[model samples]
Target chain A: MPVQDYIRDRFFPHIWCPGCGHGIVLNGMLKAIEELGLSKNEIVMVSGIGCSSRISGYVDFHTLHTIHGRALAFASGVKMSRPELNLIIPMGDGDALAIGGNHFIHAARRNIDLTAIIMNNRIYGMTGGQFSPLSGHGIKASTAPYSTIDHDFDIMELAKSAGATFAARTTTFHIKEITSIIKKAILHEGFSVVEIMSQCPTYFGKQNKLGNSFEMMELFKKNTRKIGSNKKLENKNLIERGIFIQKELPEYTNEYSKMVKIAMGKKNER
Target chain B: MKKNISFIQGNEACVQGALYAGLDLFAGYPITPSTEITELLSIRLPQKGGYFMQMEDEIASMCAIIGASLTGCKVMTATSGPGFSLMQEALGYAVMTEIPCVIVNIQRGGPSTGNPTHVSQGDVNQARWGIHGDHSIITMTASNHQDVFSVTVDAFNLAETYRTPVILLFDEVIGHMREKLIIPEKDDIELIQRLKTTVSEGVDFRPYLPRDDGRIPMADFGGTHRHNVTGLFHDMWGFPSNNPKIVDGLIHHLVDKINNNINIIAKVKEFHIDDARTILISYGASARTARHVVENRRSRGERIGLLELITLWPFPSHIIREKCRNARFIIVVEMNFGQILKEVKTCIDKPEKVFLANRVDGVLITVQDIRTILRIVQ
Candidate 1:
């Protein structure tokens, strides 16, 4: 399928900064959608306020650009309503894990069948380089003019602990891997989180002098190492990017469908 | 959706109303007076392959309902005082974003959760202006179990037709009372879903773009069109901007949609206002007491009238003004401390002539309470 087939033609040459990794992430996401064989009519994309939230505006799907930190909450409702419809949530670190952290955890814990793609571009790019929850704690940004001491969040571990059945991390630099992981995440039957370590070559780059877009992409390629284990690891110790799946308890859909069956007066034969 | 019919309570009537109106999702934390609503829905909604979940709290429940509504599913949540307070923020978001949903506030007495098991009509004002913002709403009240059945169905219809959040403002008495309600056949009702139009794929769908009459169509989630929806005041293409001109334009449209269509939206039940010297206006459970007071006075041929508001917001002020033109006094009886009375007073220039009969201590308004006010006017 043509990329044009899935994109909002009016929002072309997206508002992202030149060489920004969001465009690359969008490409990977669209590719995954195509591979899933899902029609745009059967998909809903919800996003919050941030640089990454703009992705909803460019996708040819029924989309809602909701308030900050509420995408997961909204997506949960949509998923719970029509569990058959494929729901995708795309938000940034700030929008997803920082301000919307509570909703994110609860949604994953509920094991609602939906895919959340957290674009982890270390800083708040839309508001000009403020330190995001995933930003290295001591790194200096607008919000942390002086060296900061606050601990950064571990997106993967947070999802895992919060009941995400599938959790993985990749970057725009690993285009094929990000697409492949997103495909598998979509195939998962419960809450899935694929944190894409994207490049904000504008704000985070200008703050840390990380140079041009290609330079930032190189950093992501270097920093992310593919790991193949379910064991927990300390963020301070090492970093790896790969597919993680935990198919434990039955998903929310199964339970909800059962309740619906009973409500409809269909007696349980068991 | 499977169609079935049965005699049920007013609360259960609300569930049938929701089900027949194609309400596919219900998220609520069960509370007294309103618990049967969720109970009935929990059993009924899923048989038709809808969604129903008892959330951890009223806040999450309200948010979940709002979330589902955006996906083009008719959804609702129910709660009383404290739970209603928790829902205020999301209620404000619903108002701003124009996500259509219904909220059933089975009111109880309260400065704060005064009585959970009893009846009161307080929160009438909170229902109108609970959240701080400039917005208009569709609010309806049910005086008896039958109205509970009829009005709740009306609430869902109005919410979807207007693409605005509608409040089914029920007090404890009506919410919990068991009464004969004729469960109408599916053919007997008219269901209005939010308006959706076919737009070419890949075209930017502005979810908030107003038509000529200032009503905007909502985008159904997962429908092959991209649209931006937000809490901020947005322009047609859903771009955020803070221009005062655009603000005035949008705000005017928001208020005008219902204001222009008031004839269809405003509802009231009037009694014996012809040649009456005084008019007593009441709604919700208090209307029962006011009706008794008026009926008693009428046996002696007293020239008294009753204006029972079925639709509370939009105020029905025009009808109040027109009908009460020759009246000497207007009495507003509510369970709250003069909440709806204030709105009545504001709509009329002579505020002093409008009397208030309030009951704020978690008890139902008695006939004697309204009679005391009526006797003063007499």
Candidate 2:
């Protein structure tokens, strides 16, 4: 399928920075959706406030660009009512973890069949360079100007433990891997989470003394190891990328429907 | 399909109203004074092939209903004071984005959980201006169980017609009390479905374009149009824009849509106001006491009247100005400490003419309060 087929023609040029990884990830997302053969009317792209959440605007599907940290809540409503509609949520680290942390875990725990794609750029890119809960320890940020001390959350572990049926990780640098993993997440029957380690050249790059946009992306390729690769990890601190959790559980809305059916049938019998 | 007159609580009547009005989804959180709404809907909606869900919190509940509404479902959620407070942000989102949904706020005593089981009309002002930003809202108050059913049905229709959020403000006394109500059957009841259109997938469909009457036709999301929706100041195509003219036009449309058609939005019930010296103003449960006062005064040969407001927002200032013309005194009665009185005080140039008979001591305002106010004013 042509890449332009998935893009909303009138929405360009997108509002990201010159070297931002969002556009690449967005391209991968579109390719995944296109290759999967989902029609525009059957899909709904939901997003919350952030630089990353703006992807919904540039997409041609039925899009909902909602308030900050509330995309999952709104998408749950859409999915619950029209369970046949395919729902996808694109969230930023701050949108997924900080303000939206409670909703993130709850949506995972409910195992509602919606695909959540978290764009982890370390710093709050939209609101300047404030540090997020996903900014690694000792990372310099505008809010943490003095080479500050703050621990970051492991995205896969969080999603896996919170009952996600499919939790996977890939970087924007790995375009083919990201698209393939997103496709798999979309096909999963329960809540699926995809955490893409996107580079923020304008914020995290300049703050952490990473050489430039090219170097930052290269860092992703250099410092990550796939789960099934035959190479031993010499560096213990390197990020591990793969499908961390793939277990089928009764999806929330389906279970709710069955419960309702039984209850209604019993009431009718009584 | 004759009227089924049965003894039921006001909350139950509201549920009946929702069903008769073609409600497809109910999303709400259980709160004191309004828990019965959630309890009944959780069982009733699924049985009727509609969707009912008790969300994690009031914010999610508000968002959920708005989401369901976008899919062309008539959605509703009910909550009391504290829960209503949590819903203010999502309510603003609904207003800004032009989502149609009904919200029932059963009044309870509170700055913050002051008294959960008790009744107070303290959130009347909050209902009008609770959500931040400049926007027009429609709110209706019900004084009894039967009115709760009728007003709730009307609220759904108003929301559907205007493409805006409608608030049904019911006090705790009215919400909890059991009264004999004549619930109209689904066929007999008036129902308004959202506007529908069939445009091809790639056709140019502007979702926010208003008709000559200023009502924008709404479509379900999965429909052929598949338009983009956002909460920001947006163009007719539902995409964000920062052009001065575009934002200004969009902002004006939000208020102008309802303001231009106040004749249809404002509803009131007037009694003996054509020839009277003292006028009484009230709504919700407090209007019941105002009625008793008006009746006693009329029997004693005093030409006192009552203007009971059924529709409270895009407020009925026209009715107030007309009724208060011959009335030398305009008194507002409520269970709360002067919420509706503020509207009455500002509705006319005669602010001094507006008197408030208020009680927030967790007790129902009796007819004696109105009589006491009349004696003191005289």
Candidate 3:
């Protein structure tokens, strides 16, 4: 099927700013769904409030544009109640790690069957440019005019440690990797986390003198190396990009189904 | 027929009522006085193949149930004063999205974490105006376990009928106290199932468009009719709309859907109100004490009666006006410092006649306490 088949064309042009990386993430996501041959009726795209969250509105799937920081929580409910549906949750860096941090970690801990795509732009693009949890130290934002004192945590590491069965990281510069990683994450039976390093050229780019969208994409290419690449030995600070964790764990809904059977059996005995 | 009766806590009774009302999903966080509902459901839900989740916090619980409700599941969440406060934002989201779900707030002493184990009726106003918006909500309460069971079923029915969140506002006393509840058979009580859109696949399905009966028929999340659901003011297609006309129409529809149907929504139990000179208005656990006082005073020929409110919001002003029309004294009995009393005053013709008899120090308002206030007012 064509990628346009998975999009709701009437809602476009999307509300994302010019040269915003969120649009690339949305394009990659739709291509992934198209490549996987998933039906629109079986896919539920749940998103939180941000430029990235607007992806739910643009998609042809069953969409839920929820409150900030609670997409995973809402997706958990949808997936648990209807286990046959595929849940793809897209969230902004601030929407995922700041207000929604607690729910994010808890959702990973449950190992619920959800594909959480953290569109990490390192800044709050929706409410203008506020420093986010993923905004590394010394980055200037609207809320942090003097540059940030807070350091950013690695989302892949956080998700893995919080019990996510599948964790990966990619950048919008690697468009093919974004699509492939999202496809794998969706196919994973357990909780999956894919942090796509998207760009907010209008905010994080201009505020920090990172030039425009092209320059930011160039930075992503230069700073990140494929995981286990020999170039990582030359530069210890180079961010590694690849699937970090992919193993089987008991998914929440699947385990709950077995428990439900046992519970019913016990009730019959009573 | 063999009677199915169980002497259980009010929280357990609420669970039975929810299951009876076809509740398929429950997400809750443990809080004092309201934890039993969560605890009981965790054991009972799975036995019936229903899903129950103890979410990280109250906000997640509220959001989760709203998500489940969108998938055409009858969903619920339980909390107390502090937890309900945490759920306010998501509750507003549920209101804007018109998700059919039930929220049970077993009231404890409030403002902050005032009292976790004791009863208070202070959340009466909060349930109506807690979510920040020009919107109306359906909030019901009950004085005993039997009423708790029936009212909980009514809450789900109202939620599905209107495609809105229904608040079951029971106090801590009613939640924790044990009482006898006679469980009705499945066919004994009427159950309102979710109304789904008949719009077929490959056709446009407007999820927010109300029918002639003023109900927006829903399409499940994983169904063939895929549409957007957002907290922003949206059009019939459920896409975010900043259009002034769309915004104006959506807000009016959200408010008027519940407020305009107050006659069908209002539920109250009247005792000796026909020829009474003094009428006592009360709800939740406090209504029990008020009923005892009314019965005692009526035996002494004091011409007193009790108006036990089952439905608290949209305030039931017409019923209050009609019930208090012939009464010389209308005393509002509750456990808060004049929460319902303020509403009764606004609804009645004689505001001065509407006096408040309340207790707010974490103790359940007793019959004698109401009598002392009645003596002073009479």
Candidate 4:
């Protein structure tokens, strides 16, 4: 399947910055969706505010570009009504964590059947380089002039603690890994999250003097280590980039449908 | 035929009314004074093969219903003041996109969670202008459970007809108060559904363009045409447009769609206003008190009247100006610090004649409170 087939091609020339990792992550998602033979009409892409939210506007699917951090809530409504339709949510670090963090935890806790793609660009790119929850301590940001005293969130750990049945981490440099992991997350029956540590050469990169887009991609290459890659997570500097967990918990809609069936049964009996 | 009147709460009346009016889905977060609506819906909607989801929060609850409404469902959410506050942003989204959904905000006292379990009609103005944008809204109020039943049906009807979010604004007094309600059968109600587009297949349909009737034709997601629905100002084809001409049309149509149809949208009940000189203007629980005073005063030949507003928004300015023209004075009664009182004054030639009987002590405005105001004005 061609990549263009899954896009509203006219909406291309997307608003992501030049050499921004968001476009690569978006392409990976498009390729994953196309490879799965999913019909764009039967799929709905939801997004919150940020640089990444523009993904919904560009996608040819039934897209909803909603309020900052409310995309998951809106997507839940869509999925609840039309359980047969697949839902995908793409969000940036600040959008998924700072403003929408409550929704993220609760949505995962429900184990709702949806794919949440958290593109971790490390800083607030759209708002002109404010530090994010994923922007680690000692990072420089427009908001963090004296080196941020705050620690960053381990997104995969957050997802797992919040009862996400499928949680994984990959970077934009690991293109094949993100694509395959996204496909796996989509096939998972419960709440699934794929945290892609994509570089933001414009914001985090320039602010921290971490080189350009190419250098930041190299930074991800040097640090990340997939589980069972003969490397242990005991090393504090190493990043884990494999499926953290995939368990068989009942998806939200399916259990709700069971209750629906029981209710309908009582109605028929009456 | 038999009168099937039964004792019920105002919140329960909304459930019965919604079921009768083809309620297909309910997405809400439970809050005090409004939780009963969600509890009953949890059991009833599924039994009727409709969708009900206890969303994670009020924001999601509002967002979810808008999503369901897009796929052709008559959706609703119930909340009190605090929860309704969380819903304001998404409410603006619904208004901006022209989606049809109902929001039942049972009023609770508050600047910030002032009195959650107590009653106050303080949110009347908030329900209208709370969303920060140039837009118009439909707001209905029910004094008792019976009015709650019929007006909920009407709320959904107006939401679908005008394609806007309708507010069923009441208070904890009415919501929790037990009143005799006659639930209508399915065949006995007038239900309105969203107007489906007739634009042909394979042709790119302009989903936001006003049809010949001055209303946009909506095509659901997964319909023949994959038209876009967005919060940003968009063109006829549903694509985001920065063109000045298109943005002008978008903003104008959003407010004008409901403003142009105020006559069909605004609803009020007049009591003894025909030959009265001193009148009391009120809605929701306060109106109940005002009605009692009006009835008693009229019996004593006091020449007093009550304009009970069932529909509070699109503010009904012309109706107030016309109905109260003969009155020497009008007391705007409510459980707030002069919210609707401002709107009442705006509609009258003698703005000074419209006086306010404001109350915000977390108590329902009583008949005595209104009677005293009536005496002072007279």
Candidate 5:
């Protein structure tokens, strides 16, 4: 399907600033949806407040633009209510791993059959350049005027630890890789996390003097390595980018399906 | 012949009622009075092919019910004082999003953790406005085990009909007290499945719109009509918008949806009002005592009557005001420090003659206690 046909064209002239990586991530999602042959009615898109959250309005699907950081909790209810439905949650860095961090872990731990797409732009872009949980150490934000002291959370690692069945990471610069990973994440049977390392040309890019959207996209491209590219870029090296991680844990759907069968068996016996 | 079943507790009846309602999910954490509702369901739900989960806490339990309800399942959660406080936010979300579910709060005493195992009707105000913001509700209060069974089943029907959360506000005394409940077979009782909306092929499916009859049909989340769900004030399409007219229209629709159906929501029972000099207004367990108190006075050739409020919210103001209009006195009896009494005062044109007989020591009010108040007021 044409991107224009899939998106609500009236809400478009997309909200992201020129060259913002969120646009790329969203495109990857549209492509994934098309490739899977998923009907729009089969997908419920939930989002929290932020630039990334705006994706709900743009997409031609059932959507809930929910409260800050509670998108996962609401999605949990939606998924639990209709286990047969495919639920996708798109949130900014602050929404996924900061204010909503608790729900993220618990949902993953339960292995609720859902997909969470975290757009990690490394800074709080919407409310001006403030320090987000994903911001690098020594980086300055509106709140962190001086060199930042807090260590950033590795969201992919956190997802793996929290019992995510599928975990992967990619930057917006690697469109094909991010799209491919999203396809894999959607197909995963349990809680899947695709942490798209996107770029914020407006606030984050300007603060770091990264020129504009093109420069930020260039940065994403420079940093990422392709999945199975075997190009080991050191973490310390700023230009290093690649599919830094990939793994499969016990998917929650299988476990829950077992629970349903057991519960049903008892019902039949009685 | 009607089955004159032996006495059973109100909480136990609520459990039986849940089964009769074809409840598919029971998620709750144990709290006094209300705990038996969960205990019974934990055992019985699995037998019926339903799901039961004892969540980490009340918050998770609340979320679980919301989750299950979304799956096109009838769900219920029971809690008391502190647990009810924890559930307010989720409850608010349910109200806003128009999710169908049931919540049972067997109230205990407190602004905090007051009386865990004791009866108190202190949650009346909390039930009405527990969550922040303006919203209308479908609520029922059961004064005895029979009402518990009937009202609980009714609660399920109301939830499905209105597509909103319905609170079954029972108190600790009634929750724990054993009384006879003639359990009805599943087939004899009517059960309501939530109204499902049709996604018109061309027109956008607006989940929040009030039907011509002022009710919204809830969509099975995954079945079809993947709608934009939000806490923000949105148009019928469920997209978040801050437009002034949209917000006004949405709030008005939510409130009017219930208000328009007020006649169906208000339920009360009247007793011995003809030529009575005094009227005793009460609900929940206290209503049982007031019944006996009025009976004793009637046996002595004294003129007295009782008004039992089965539905607490929307306050039954017209019935109350009319009932108390000609009475010499109106006595409000409860097991707490005067919550519903204030509501009575608002309903009555004559407030000075209104007497409050309240007890907060976590004990069930006796007929003698109400009799003593009747004497003092007389």
Candidate 6:
């Protein structure tokens, strides 16, 4: 199927700024869904409040544009109640780490069948560039006028530590990799975390002298290396981009079904 | 027919009522007075193939149920004062998005965790106006376990009928106190199932478009009719709209749906209200004491009566006005410092004739306490 088949063409042009990396993430997500041959009716795309969350509006799937930081909590319920539906939750940096941090970790810990895409722009673009938990130290934002003293969290590390069965990282610069990783994450059958290092050229890019969208894309290409590449030995500071963890685990919804069966059996015995 | 009876707490009765109402999913966080609803559902729901989720916090519990409701499930969550406060934002979301779910806030002493184990009716106003915006909500309360079960079932029915969230506001006294509840048979009570659209696949399905009866039939999240659901002021297609006309229409729709049906939504139990000179008004656990006072006083030929309010929101002003039209004085009995009293005053023609008999402290108001006020008013 054509990629446009998965998009709500009437809602476009989207609300994202020019050269925003969120569009690329959306494109890659649609490509992954198309490649997987998933039906729009079978997919539920839940998003939190942010520029990245606008992607839910552009998708033709069963979309839920929820409050900030509660997308995963909402998605968990949808997945648990209707295990047949595929839940794909997309969130912004602050939406995922700051206000919604507890839900993100707990959703991972439960190993529920959800595909969480953290659109890491390192800034709160919807509210006009406030520093986020993904904004590393010395970063400038509308909130952090003099640059931030707070260090950023590693999204992949957090997901892994929180017991996500599948964790991966990719950037918009690596568009093909984003699609590939998302496809794998969706098919993983457990809680999956895929952090897409999307760009906010209007906010994060201009605030820090990152030149322009092109320069930022170049920076993503220059700063990241594939996981386990020999270049990582040469530059320890270079961010690794690739699937870091993939394993079989007891998914929450599947385990719940088994539990229900046992409970019914016990009730019948009485 | 053998009677299916069980002596249980009010919280357990709520669970039974929800299950009987075709509850498919329940998500809750443990809080005082309301925790038993969560505990019992965790055990009972699975036995019936229903899902029970103990979410991380109150906010998540509320959000989760909203999500489950979108997937065509009869969902619910229980909490207390603090948890209900945490759930206000999500509750507003559910209202704006028109998700059918039930939230039970077992009232406790509040402002800020004043008394977790004791009863208070302070959340009356909060339940009415807790969420910021112009909207209407359905809130119900009961004085006893049997009433709790029936009111809970009514809550789900109302939620489905209107595609809105319903609040079951029972105080801590009713929540924890054990009483007899006869679980009704499946066919005994009428249950309102979710109304789904008849629009077939390949056709445009406007999820927010109301039918002639003012109800917007739902299409499950995973169904053929895929659409958007947002908390923002949206169009019939459920897409966000900033047009002033659209916003105005939506606000009116949200508020008018429940407010316009005030007479139909309001539920009250009137005892000796027809010819009583003095009418005592109360709800939740406080109504029990008020009823005792009315019954005891009436035996001696005292012209007193009690109006136990089952539906609290939409205020039931018309009913209150009609019931107290001939009364010499109206005494509003509750455990809060004039929460419902203020509402009663606004609804009645003679505000001065309406007096408040309340107890703000943690202790439950006794029949004697209301009697003292009755003596003063008489």
Task: Determine the C-alpha RMSD for candidate 5 after optimal superposition of all C-alphas.
Answer: 3.2
Reported per model, the fraction of native interface contacts reproduced equals: 0.69, 0.59, 0.89, 0.68, 0.54, 0.87
lDDT of all predictions = 0.81, 0.88, 0.93, 0.88, 0.81, 0.93
Model 1 chain B weakest 10-residue run by lDDT:
B1-10
Write the residue-wise lDDT of candidate 5 on B1-378 in tens digits: 676375778888888888889888887888876888888787677666567776657876886687667768998999998999988888887888888899999999887988788888888889999999999887789788888999999999988888889999999888888878888755676888778777665656777777787778777666556566677788787767899999898788778778777777888898898677899989998998899999888999988999999888867887788777889999998887788899899878879999998788888899778878877989
Q: Against the true structure, what is each candidate's TM-score? A: 0.87, 0.97, 0.99, 0.97, 0.89, 0.99
Q: At residue A177, what lDDT does model 5 achieve?
A: 76
Q: What docking grade does candidate 3 earn?
A: high
TM-score of chain A of each: 0.92, 0.97, 0.98, 0.96, 0.90, 0.98
Q: DockQ score for model 2, please? A: 0.69
Candidate 3 stretches with Cα past 4 Å from truth are A268-270
lDDT of 6 at B364: 89
Q: What is the per-residue lDDT of model 1 for residues A1-270, given as tens digits with 9 covering 90 to 100?
A: 776798868667778999888888899999998988877788888888899998987887777777778788777787887778888999999999887888888888888898999999888888888998888777778889885678887888888888899998898899999889999988888899999988887788877888898998888765556685433243434468887655767899788877666655773431
What is the Cα-based lDDT of residue B266 in candidate 1? 94
Candidate 3: which pairs clash?
none
Go through the candidates in order and give each one's DockQ.
0.46, 0.69, 0.91, 0.72, 0.44, 0.91
Clashing pairs in 2: none
Clashes of each: 4, 0, 0, 0, 21, 0
Candidate 1, residue A51: how far the Cα is off, in Å:
2.0
After aligning candidate 6 to the native by TM-score, how far in Å is the CA of B327 from where it should be? 0.8
Any runs in candidate 2 off by more than 4 Å, and if so which?
A: A228-233, A266-270, B1-3, B198-201
Error of 5 at A125 (Å): 4.5
Which structure is stronger by DockQ: 1 or 4?
Answer: 4
User: Distance from true position, residue A3, model 3, in Å?
Assistant: 0.5
Q: Each prediction's Cα RMSD?
A: 4.1, 1.7, 1.0, 1.6, 3.2, 1.0
Candidate 3: count of backbone clashes, pairs at least 3 residues apart or interchain: 0
